[model samples]
Target: MKTFTSPALSGLPGLRHAFFTRDGGVSKGIYAGLNGGIGSNDDPADVAENRRRMAEAMGVDVAHFLTAHQIHSPDVAVATMPWSPEARPRVDAMVTATPGLALGVTTADCGPILFADAKARVIGAAHAGWKGAFTGVLENTINEMEKLGANRADITVAIGPLIRQPSYEVGAEFVARFTEADPAFARFFIPSAREGHAMFDLAGFIRMRLQRAGIVDIDDTGIDTYPDEQLFSYRRTVHRKEPDYGRQIHAIVLAR
Candidate 1:
């Protein structure tokens, strides 16, 4: 399967991660290639097989390849052992210092952020959509990692593919939500051609949140999922009037 890795986390000792694209999998139709989203309408068997591939890539057993039942909330989970799909926690991020358990987050256009503090051997995966980022998922992920003995300054974060500002147009309320939270956030929005609409910079906002959380080592894949054919995008699926959409899984694991 085709995947992207962040340079910041690539050379970290005992770390393995991948920002998987919708490139390789057995599913056909709209769920084609590496649709790891259990909540998606894709065939269950195909999803299992796809996750198995991801687990193998991360050098862990399929059972140990973990992802939460994301709710776009700031909730974070600490994974010490694998949980069944039916039992996945309702959270947007996960952190772990335990070796062999791969933490993953499923997303289409939402940001997938992988974090690692090599010195502490702690790793985290966060699903940072606008709501999650605005509500503190990124900071919560770091806090959870800190609880596991990670130092925020020693942590390195890699932001994976997501909807970039150029392709992410939002209504007035969306812009209002950010600016209302902090007037300074207005800078992340640019007027779109459509009236009462603006392009939102999700990546930039994510980076800002990381920096604000005191994380200095960061990297971004800079891939826009909306226009990238290799990646699945929820907004693209909606624009095309497709009945359902697939999701890509971005994951991290400590191999020690």
Candidate 2:
């Protein structure tokens, strides 16, 4: 399977992480290539086998590879052990200090952020869509990691693939939501070709938030999922009128 690693997290000791691409899996058609999204409509067996491969790559047992039932909320969960798919927490982010457990987040166009504090042996994975990022999922993930003995300054974050601003145009109300939250947020948007619409810089906004939270060691793969065929994109799928889309799994694990 193809995977991308960030330099900030790659040099860290005692942990493993990957920003998996839409490559190397058994699923066919729309769900092909490492579709680890359990909530997706792909064949259950195919999804399971794909996840097994991801878990193996992370050096964790398949059962220990955990992802939440993401709701695009700012909620965060702390994982102490493996949970069955039926029992996955309904949250946007997860943190764990426990070794042998992989914290994962599934995404198509949303941002997949992997975090680690090697000194504290704490790791986190957050699924940050526009709503989740605006509502504070990134901050919550850092706070949860702090609670697990991670110092914010010591935590290195790696942002994975997501739809870039050029491919992410939004209506007036979407721009209003961010500006209403903070007028300064208006800078994150630029005029789009369509009237009453603007291109939103999701990655830039995410980076701003992390900096505001005092995380200096941050690395972004800077891979835009929308135009990149190697990655899956929800918007791309929608524009094409496809029935369903695949999701790439990005995970981080503290070594045992």
Candidate 3:
């Protein structure tokens, strides 16, 4: 199966990871190719098989490739071991320090961030939509990692493929919400053609947040999901008036 990795996390010892794209797997129509979103409308069997492929690629048992329900909240779930889909918690991020356990998060348009502290054998995965990011999901993920013995300075994070600034337009209220939280955030938005809308630099904003959290090593894939046919995009689905969309998986594991 096709996958991407960040240079920042690629050289880490005893870690395995992939930022998967919608290029491999068994699904049809809009959900074609590596659709791993367990909560999506895609057939359960297909999703299961796709996830199995991801787990195999990460060198873990199929049952060990774990992901959460992702409610776009700041909530984070710590994983000591794998859990069945029925037992997955309702959260937007996951962290793990246990060997042989994989932490994953699914996303279409939202950012999928993978983090690792090789020295501590700790790793994290987060779904950073605008709501989740603004509300502190990234921060919460790091805090949980620290609780598991990861140091912020030792952490290396990768911002995976997502809707980039050029394709991400926001309403005035969206801009206001961010600026209200911190006026300096206004720089992430640039005026768009729409009277009250502006383009948002989501990746840049995410990087700044990581910097503020004391993380020094960061890498962004710089791949935009919206126009990339190889990746699934919720906004692209919406714009096409499709009834549903697929999601790609981003996972990191502390290898056994």
Write model 3 residue lDDT over 18-46, tens digit each, in one string: 99998779998889999998878999999
User: Per-residue alpha-carbon lDDT of model 1 for 1-256, expressed as tens digits?
Assistant: 7899998889899989999988779888999898998998999999999999999989999999999999999999999998999999999999999999999999999999999999999999999999999999999999999999999999999999999999999999999988988999999999999999999999999999999999999899999999999999999999999999999999999996
Candidate 1: where is the Cα deviation over 4 Å?
Answer: none
Best by lDDT: 1
Prediction 2 TM-score vs. true: 0.99
Judged by lDDT relative to the true structure, which candidate is superior, 1 or 2? 1
Clashes of each: 0, 0, 0
lDDT of 2 at 249: 94
What TM-score goes with each of the models? Answer: 0.99, 0.99, 0.98
- Model 3's number of clashes is 0
Residues 1-256, candidate 2: write the lDDT tens digits: 7899999898999998999997889888988788988878999999999999999999989999999999999999999989999999899999999999999999999999999999999999999999999899999999999999999999999989999999999999999989998999999999999999999999999999999999999999999999999888999999999999989999999888
Colliding pairs, model 2: none
lDDT for 77 in candidate 2 is 98
Error of 2 at 8 (Å): 0.8
lDDT of 2 at 148: 92
